[model samples]
Target: MAYRSQIRGEFIRRYSECKAAYLETSWRMIHERDVKHRALNTEFGYPEPDGSFGIGCKSSVDQEYKRRYDEIESRFRKPYDDQLPALHRWALENSMSVYECLLMDDIWDDDLKALAKLSTMEEDWQFQPIIAKARFMVARWKEEHVVGEIQRRVKIESSHFHYAAARCRNLLGLKPWDLAAQKAIFDYGKEWKSALEFAFGSLTAA
Candidate 1:
């Protein structure tokens, strides 16, 4: 059966792909703007209408600066803008359904929103309970399964060791003086010791 974690992993993979595209475009825009902005400052001799020249300086050249910045941004942004329709199309076509999305973690809300907008899905406000329920269920099932497995293995190990020890003793008729019989019986004890260790050690370490 498919677990919530497995489904969430798949969603994160697709969400990451969409996020990378958004980040790459944003980074390119910011980098180009910074480079051109510095050049603009130099071209205008770093004008300062307020008589200050460091960060947050206002300049008399504001209009010209805006014009140039807009030009640079528009040039870099056109390709991304053009591709948005196709991006949205892909997001809608391949994005997880709302049911599958309910299995996702809330930590992914921001990324999920970006993809959800592209896919035209409801935002977090509309589906808050989905994530809450998903988180609760995943936690519940994890606790149940882990505890159940540990209990089960412990019982099996105990039962097998008890039966093996008794059977070995019964077959021996009396305590064996020979090394072969001694080795044979001790082997079962060694094997069950390992099994018991494994049963308890299966728990997560703090």
Candidate 2:
């Protein structure tokens, strides 16, 4: 397998950067926005924004999350639109479930096209350099999907094992043994895929 050193280097850098971002995601980042909505508002009504602060009674907070979810999803589509589909198919066939497929329906047909366009891309992307491209796709889509899930999870969602592929990057690389050295460097960060994994993992387990 032939690999472009520059592309491979870019992949390695991207992988490490994404991993660092994942690690940087603190509990504060996850919940602060929700908490601030509660603090800044001053209303009266059962669980109304500025009304109630309790977890169960906050309809305003629920609506806020819904709005944030919509915005987040719209942003997520840009990346999803670019992610490679063959990698998605590979992960889906190997470990993903039907619920995952359903949950992953693009917010619109454009997202669907993003997932399907791979079949007809240029030859190198479609066939000759599949594994290398798949590596790129797995990493690419993994980020897109993870960011999407961070904002929401429905009854239906898909499983993600791209990190498994990420780990097997060596086997998936250009040479039999001369795989990119960054694979080892980025291995731990790839576990962030587990967050995306468990999001859909429960879909199959159920």
Candidate 3:
């Protein structure tokens, strides 16, 4: 296995390359389809956008368009979708967490530094990293998927941070949140304070 950061970088690079290839293929297929449509319209005397045509000829053109659309999707898109599973498997084999694989780019740089600091800090050894990681995950969750009114309220409620953090910590098989854990994460340093401002709306509280 390679260094973890190297593995991560490679995964992102390959994934981006795959996406770029798919987009290029898709655009080429679309252009080809458009040219074919224009040629068909000329050959069959199908009506232009501003012209009228017989219902029978229009129906024939619609069927031809559908067939070409399906052909392009299968030929240009399915291979890219199939390649995605292999990339996911590589990420799993390298011991990268789901969060690391999916949201690594989305995580703020300062929050990453705060997590690094918590990992190395000796003071409040047990709670420092755990609470911070859990809370950050909760924050990211809200950012990613908070779409409904209930979810919005849950994200902003005064006590919801503790509740969400505690639940996330439990899912990771860690102890519950407490005042000490909170302080250790938010009050330890500027890195953590910045992270807290990100997780919650501001630095006021969490």
Candidate 4:
């Protein structure tokens, strides 16, 4: 019995090591792809007026950027699409789901939620509670990390101001005045104030 316990402990340790290695490799690949994508976007002058590429006409620069973006995106997706099935199978063999495995690896709850959607793991009743928990965890995380940081940087950019206020509005369903006064203490000029008024008006109308 003692030998069996020792062997079980060793197996657990090895499994944890393998899981950590897999997560590290996967995250590194993703991070590298993101960096490349951002660099390519900078080269192509992304976030055109319409928030899309080829605003005026498809220049060679635009085409090259698009090609690189597509390539990187494809490479990023390949591991998830190709390896996920095998991973899922392994998880199932261990009486777990891929979502469970990701959770065990301490992946962000939002990412797990996305994976759950992509994998169509919603069909399982067991997965529903995990999804709910993930949502709660994400909200708590955003409240703790994102909301506070954005509030601090509200004066840095109009986008940051809008994003911080929007988070409060969307997450907590607070009124714009309350969100602006409490979360984002920004002294908006006429344009932003007018825009916010229009946005709030539209929301109230809707």
**Which candidate wins on lDDT?**
1
For residues 1-206, write the lDDT of model 4, one tens digit per residue. Answer: 11111112222333444455566778888778777776676566775566654322233456776677787778878885555455444544654322233233434434444443433443322233323333444344445565445333323433444553444344333455674334222432223333433433343355
Q: What is the Cα-based TM-score of model 1?
A: 0.37
In lDDT terms, how accurate is model 1? 0.48
Clashing pairs in 2: 43-50, 100-157, 100-158
Q: Tens digit of lDDT per residue, candidate 3, span 53-122?
A: 3222243347765565455445645655555456445545655432233223333544555555554454
User: Which window of 10 residues has the lowest lDDT sum in candidate 4?
Assistant: 1-10
Tens-digit lDDT track of model 1 for 1-206 = 21222234445446657656866776777676667666666666675666434222235468887677566667767765656455445544664432233223222545455434433344323333233332333344446577667556456644555455444344333265655445544553454354445434444433
The number of clashing residue pairs in each candidate reads: 0, 3, 0, 0
Q: lDDT for model 2, on a 0 to 1 scale?
A: 0.37
Off by over 4 Å in 1: 1-8, 47-66, 77-88, 100-206
The residue-level lDDT of candidate 4 at 91 comes to: 44
Error of 1 at 13 (Å): 1.5
Error of 2 at 69 (Å): 17
Which 10 consecutive residues of model 2 have the lowest summed lDDT?
Answer: 1-10
**Cα lDDT computed for each candidate against the true fold:** 0.48, 0.37, 0.45, 0.44
Estimate the TM-score of every prediction.
0.37, 0.23, 0.36, 0.34
RMSD of each: 24.8, 18.0, 11.6, 19.2
